[model samples]
Target chain A: MADLRINLAGISSPNPFWLASAPPTNTGYQVQRAFEAGWGGAVWKTLGDPIINTSSRFAAVHFNGQRVAGFNNIELITDRPLEVNLKEIAETKKRFPNHAVVVSLMVEPKREKWHEIVKRVEAVGVDGLELNFGCPHGMAERGMGSASGQQPDLVEAQTMWVKEAAQTPVIVKLTPNITDITMTAIAAARGGADAISLINTINSLAGVDLDSWNTIPHVGGKGAHGGYCGPAVKPIALNMVAECARSPHIHIPISGIGGISNWKDAAEFMLMGATGVQICTAAMHHGFRIVEDMIDGLNNYLDDKGLASVSELIGKSVPRYSDWGDLDLNYQVVARIHEDNCIVCNKCHIACEDTSHQCIERLETSDGRSYLKVREEDCVGCNLCAIVCPVEDAITMVEIPSTELPMSWNQRQKAIGSMGQNEAPGAKEAV
Target chain B: MSDYGLFQEEKNRLDAYISRQFKIVGITENLSGATVELEHPGGGQAEVRLLTAEGRKYMSNLVIKQFTAAN
Candidate 1:
């Protein structure tokens, strides 16, 4: 067994896994069951002035059979009465004393409204507060969600107001719609946010319905771009986390969100210096019971790698990440496609030819059958084609021998730069 | 089976099978050569090699398995 407990801002959890503020934590009953099932905490769904929630509120896209690759929603902040949500939070906290229960809040952009929400939530025995400034859909249109986050100054001022209003720790959930994440992060840190979490989701149109020529989740036969989250957003979320971690002015702990579906995804977030990983889409796609796999997977990974504690693995790989110049110039690879067992699908060829470098070739058989092949010279070894290919044991990127090719781009750039400087046509310039 | 013997057998089987699949100037194991050059069936050259010990182990184990591209 590995030590999975983590202490963030003086609040400790049995594990760093917290249910993101979503439908799973929409009520105390839902959250209590989540804790019993081994979740470390639950950020009770975003609470605001009670409003009407429409029927048919969500739209989704599926990928690779069982996974929800992307998710969108017209859903607004918590529609349940504030007092009812508060009562549930208080009771759940009383029962699961060890688990963290942070309440997610969204309110009008006023000092009085925010101050009142903070005071009321803290009295319910929550360990912390995550200001819901990141919801990019319905609430944003109302000037309460991402609209507040898009302006850095407003994010700063609102966070400070909450800090003054609440005695417990406060986390600012940031929107991904911003061009620069560091600006918002720095603003939150300046405003006294104990931590920062992202990214609420990106505004996106999942797809359009061709029959009525209308878009999906059509409210009155029209659809707006809703916040996109799921496995698809992991890379974008990861880059933002690293940016915030690397920023000198923003040193607060980051609660990584967006598309974390498994322990490996969670570990990747932690390695990028996230204090904890918050998840929604994975839970929404599968169920809260998936947390068990997350717990066991993380524990087994820690044990197998000889890591004594979860903390030891946090941000362990951040130092190895660096700029392009930091990469070893000598490293190289070539794409390999095994011929005998090839299933003759042209996915690899289409991916390489259409999207990536013109590297893959398709060969025809005597019986008019054709299979995909990789061209050596053009293949930059990006592995995008291989990653997209569905067949197992199909395509692999093998490292090129160092002596086979001299520093390719390196020597070429050097040669091109010294063309005019050289005394003779092919004369070598002194270093 | 010993690792060396296993590597030798797998390498020999792959060399023979690939030789028959694509028309090429026959395959040879030049352990003395430092480079791994792969000649594509489509008149292109790839000068890449499996460098690390871990990579060689993975390649040896999976070399003989069948492969296919997805549509």
Candidate 2:
């Protein structure tokens, strides 16, 4: 078996999968159960001043027949007492001596409050501390959670305070509910954070009950915005991770969260620059046993790829991801319909005719059989026809080799700008 | 006419000037299209407007080629 062990910054885990500091990691019992069920590590839920939580605090967006395509929650940090959580953290760490036990913390933005919490949490012999500046709901209203996290200055100051007292590695979990997540990431780096994790969650509302004219998961007939996570937010989370990973300033091990559901998702995050991945929504949907499949699938994938260790996947694709202006303008692809595999459904023809460039044409064969063919010259290769085709191999987009030299939009513009205002020859003067 | 046909017509026009020993002197691009200026050594000059994406790309390639040859 390929070595699945990973050491993110200074926190070593048997595998790269750690349970995110969410509802799943709310208690020692749950976190211990997760570790027993094959989770490599767990970040205990955010600890600070305990508060009461509402009954209707969770909602899910079911896309088509898929249950919990996206999960949203207005839930606050650990409602249990600070002593109770600390005792459990100490006990859990003692029980699973080999497993990574990182404690997540959130409190008022005071320097003393941050220092005290960091010292208290580290005293329990935890592997690391994740500063929870990313819970985006009830706590944000009190100027905690995403409130202080939104301001780069506040994020930096709180991280500095925590670092002053923290003996263990400190990870600053970043909130995505901002214009740019890299701003907070850079701030955390400046504050001497040992590592960083993203993205906490995006501000979202699940949906509304059209019949009752009330919001989904409305408590006492009222609702507030919640933090969104789960499979549907994978693209958004992946992009943010990529953005931070590719940045030059924010150089820290990333504990990627937000919509990581399975081993494939974990591998993608790792490839995009996450040193490790944290799971919550998937475990919430299908219990803690899901980590078994994740572990098995990841091991099999690593072995098949001829890699001896899972850590080899980290930041492998970062060099391939780039800005749009760097793309070659002369590179082209066109839709090609395979007659043998086609079902003659005319979906491709209709999609091309109505929406995309009019390229795919219906033609009657010599034997009077109807078929679709793409006009290679006019087909812009938008992939609309291939997307709408019901049969998988019916339509394929093939690259057309360009005879001309490659030129990007940036290069073309630069060349044009260098020419600088040349008047057309033989043009009439203003007369 | 199809977009390809318009691009072919513009490409032919550009090639015709080159065949007549005309060298590209200037190019002006605006919302309308790209206007290419060409001058022959015998003191004759001509201008052509290219309105298609392919035609503009073709014009750019020629300009780059001219730059490479000069340098």
Candidate 3:
């Protein structure tokens, strides 16, 4: 088996799968259960001063029979007293000595409060600390969670304070609610954060019940926007991870968290520069046992790829991610229909004729048999025909000769501007 | 206008076919000849260089046939 173990910013884990700080990691018992289920680590739910929570603190949206495609939560950090959470953290660490137990912490923005919390959590022998700069709903209003996370300066100052008092490595968890997440990531690095975990949930109103006109998971017939997570947020989370991975300004280990459901999802995040990926909704939906497949599958994937370990997969695809202008505009592909595989439902034909470019032609052969063919010259390679085709493997996109050479828009502009000529040539010189 | 004509007989059919099939962006007439700019179906602009009588006759016939037959 390929080595699945990972040492992220000095905090080592048996594997790269960690339970995100959520309901799944709410207590020592829950975390111990997770370790038993084969998770390498768990960031115990955010711990701080106790607070009263609403009765219905969670709401979820489902799509195509998938439970909680997007999950929303109004739940605050751990409601248990700080001492209780601290004691549990110690107990959990003692029980799972090899497993990573990073304490998630949130406290007043004051320097002393952060210092005090960091010291207490570190004293428990936890592997590391993740600054809960991200709970985006009820906690931000109190200027404790996302309020500080949204501001880079605040993230820097708070992280600095925690780092000053903490013995363990600090992982600054970031909020997705911010305009540019990198700003806060860079700030955390400046403040001496050992690692970064993202993205904390997005601010969302789950949905309103049309009949009752009430927000979902209504707290006493009323509702507030909560933090959104789960499957629907994976694309957003992946994009953020890729951006951070590509940027040289922020150099820190990333613990990717948002809508990761399986080992494939974990691999994508890892390839995009996350050292480990913390998961919540899947564990919430499928229980902690899901990590069994996550661990085995990742090991199989690494072995199949001829890689030695999970660290080898990290940031492997970062070089391929780039701006739109950097993409090769001259690269072209056209749709090709397979006569043998085509079901000929006329879906692709009709779609191309009415909605997209009218490039498909239904031709009658010499034997009075009719079949659809693409007018390649007019195809545009838009894939509209392929998209509307019901049959799999019926239509395939084939690369064709391009009008331009291998050059991007950015390169084209540079070539034009370098000659000290104001007026650039037309089509003749574009390539 | 007829002095340098190549396919004077097919001009009307080609014009009707090209105009009905594609959107004409602009036509520029330089000292050499005319360049008819037409919007490509996918995106961007495709220029038909009618700089010479032969060039005009050849390109117009090819594009007109391609568009009209596809329809």
Docking class of 1: incorrect
lDDT of candidate 3 over A193-212, digit per residue (tens): 99999999999999999999
Candidate achieving higher TM-score, 1 or 3:
3
Q: Candidate 1 iRMS, in Å?
A: 20.3
What is candidate 2's CAPRI-style docking category based on DockQ? acceptable
Q: Which candidate's DockQ is highest?
A: 2
lDDT of 1 at A334: 74
Winner by lDDT: 2
- What is the C-alpha lDDT profile of model 2 across A222-307, one tens digit per residue? 99999999998899989999999999997889999989999999999999999999999999999999999999999999999999
Please report how far candidate 3 places residue A288 from its true position, in Å.
0.8
Task: Return the TM-score for candidate 1, rounded to 2 decimals.
Answer: 0.76
Candidate 3: where is the Cα deviation over 4 Å?
A350-355, A362-370, A384-388, A401-404, A419-431, B1-71
Q: How many residue pairs clash in each candidate?
A: 4, 0, 0
Instruction: Summarize candidate 1's per-residue lDDT along A238-342 as a digit string, tens digits.
Output: 989888877778878888898999999999999998888888888887888999999999999999999888988777777767656445444668788987656
Candidate 3, residue A298: how far the Cα is off, in Å: 1.3
State candidate 2's TM-score.
0.95
